[model samples]
Target: MTETLLLIGILALFGVGLYGMMILHNFIKLVIALQILTKTAVLAFVIAGEMNGQIQLGQSLALTVIVADTMVAVVGLALAVQVRRHFGTLDIRALSTLKR
Candidate 1:
């Protein structure tokens, strides 16, 4: 029962993240969506470990993911800030237009 609920939650997070990625144009929001997707993967790892009797491995993987995700968020936000300062906007469409 608990596992089922967790799986459902993971699916929900993934869907929300996917939707955000598809519909949002702001870099910060895109980063947040990526974070949500990463978290969903982490939660799935933990849950799989719990079910397979390898909780330690699952936890280690989740830790690694968290570290990587943190770096990604930091870099993404930094880029967003730089883009805003240089281009005067955070919209992805505007940035793309400037590229051409």
Candidate 2:
């Protein structure tokens, strides 16, 4: 049914995002992967709530998740900016060798 397909799509999104997180070297790509991962998780909950007919809980959780994801992404982006400012590059390999 449509629900099953939705589940499969969400799974595929999660898998791709996880793979992106592992393979991508750029900070922007990593952040995008993280966003994709978070979105897939939130989407699963929303779909589950819809399938089971529990409206409020799913909507609230999805909203909460969106807010939290925004906060985390903003903070992470700021940290990334700082790292780049100090290190002068966005490469993870170079970042790994940073003294501090």
- Tens digits of lDDT, candidate 1, 1-100: 9999999999999999999999999989999999999999899999999999999999999999999999999999999999999999889887876667
lDDT of 1 at 54: 99
Best by TM-score: 1
Q: Candidate 2: where is the Cα deviation over 4 Å?
A: 97-100
- lDDT, candidate 2, at 36: 95
Alpha carbon lDDT of each predicted model: 0.94, 0.90
Cα misplacement distance, residue 90 of candidate 2 (Å): 0.9
What's the C-alpha lDDT at position 2 in model 2?
93
Using lDDT as the measure, the top candidate is 1
**lDDT, residue 90, model 1:** 89
Q: Which pairs of residues clash in candidate 2, taking residues 3 or more apart in a chain or in different chains?
A: none
Candidate 1 residues lying further than 4 Å off, grouped into runs, are 97-99
